[model samples]
Target: MFKYFFVVFCLSLFIRQGLALWCYECVSTQPGCGTQFNWLFHWTKICPETDDVCVKIIEQRSDETIITRSCLSSLRAIRTDIPADHYEGCRPAAKDVHLANYVNNSIKELDIYRNYYDKTTWCFCFLDNWCNSSPSSNAHVYLIIGTSLISLVYMF
Candidate 1:
């Protein structure tokens, strides 16, 4: 019985340490810093509600813009100071001079809304240490069977 208890304890500890989840609000916040950051496995018990998740940023600018313009090269690093009132021209952080030229020159087909950050368009990730709250990762039914086999080994 002691041995069985030890196994259960170890399993519990392992499950606790197994995976971690992170969420980021890329457009609305600073780089790699925000309330959206979450440990997917643990947060459910603590908050039990909406928790923001991480993202992978992607750029659709022309090849020339990516190479020539420092700002366009790293989409993830764009500062979040874009003005709410401005819509006609480049939004500073979201702007690439080369991209503008590409569109003007007919080299790029312009889809203005596509450039902006939208939840439907943004990339998603299933991070390590994260699982949906419904069926906890600890719900592995085979764990007991594995424990029983290990205990049998000790009996021999």
Candidate 2:
């Protein structure tokens, strides 16, 4: 009986690890950051298993504007911020760039855009598949249900 319980516990742990989070990846100055645009260049990337948040930044300057999207650690997700001007010789603190915990599960996305004239926007997404341009239908949910059913059968 003890051995059976141990096996079940180990299986649960394995299933939890297998259902890791992933976020959409893209960076562009044009309108379509996640989608395709005619003149914009976009790259495809997948966040590491350790990352739990997706981040997007849009900044405008005198000469040019930029937009970026990437994955961030859960810890850095709460405290993420971008300096007004890094190219203009403003050095930000080390902690400003690191990832942090997300504040709330219900709050899927956070938008921080202070300047209307420059139109700089910073967005962070904490929910699963929030950043994906096209997400598949409830795949993770099915995996969880399947695992639970298998576990129940084994126990019986």
Candidate 3:
């Protein structure tokens, strides 16, 4: 019975991990966008399983800076760097399925920046959760370990 419970618990964890690709979602017109202090009020957005990348964009204009974040299709996420003011792509936490094709078809037309608006600076990032922080993992792991230990203690 304990063994069965353990197997079920582990399987549930794997299932949860497989079912979701969470990302940060926010848009701010403030000057310092996505900085540590600015994220205090923002929340993480649970993205669809089909979306593999979390993208963050920072645009600096003469008057004000804007920050936006969302989950994107792997195709769109790949073209983070275009001839813009500023752009960067971070390594995805999970293996991207479209990476091979993107690398092979490195054409200028395929870039996402072609549609971008003019700006002083732009930046992008691909990460697991919000800004490289996986808030759920630590809690989930602790819960699993705590449950296992309790079960063992009760059994003994």
Best by TM-score: 3
Give each model a TM-score: 0.23, 0.35, 0.42
* Candidate 2 lDDT over residue span 1-156, tens digit each: 865785678677657655554554555644566334322233434456553556555566675656556665432544346543323122332333324344344543533322322555555555554353323434554665686677677777
- Residue-level lDDT tens digits of model 1 in 58-104: 33344311111111113334433222322222223334334433344
The regions of model 2 sitting more than 4 angstroms off are: 1-18, 29-44, 49-51, 62-64, 74-119, 130-156
lDDT by residue (1-156, candidate 3, tens digit) is 867687668667658865576665666654323444244455566666563556655555465555566665432545443333222353223322444453555576763333333442333444334543323333544675687777666656
Candidate-wise lDDT, in order? 0.35, 0.49, 0.50
Give the backbone clash total of model 1.
Answer: 6
Worst 10 residues of 2 by lDDT: 86-95
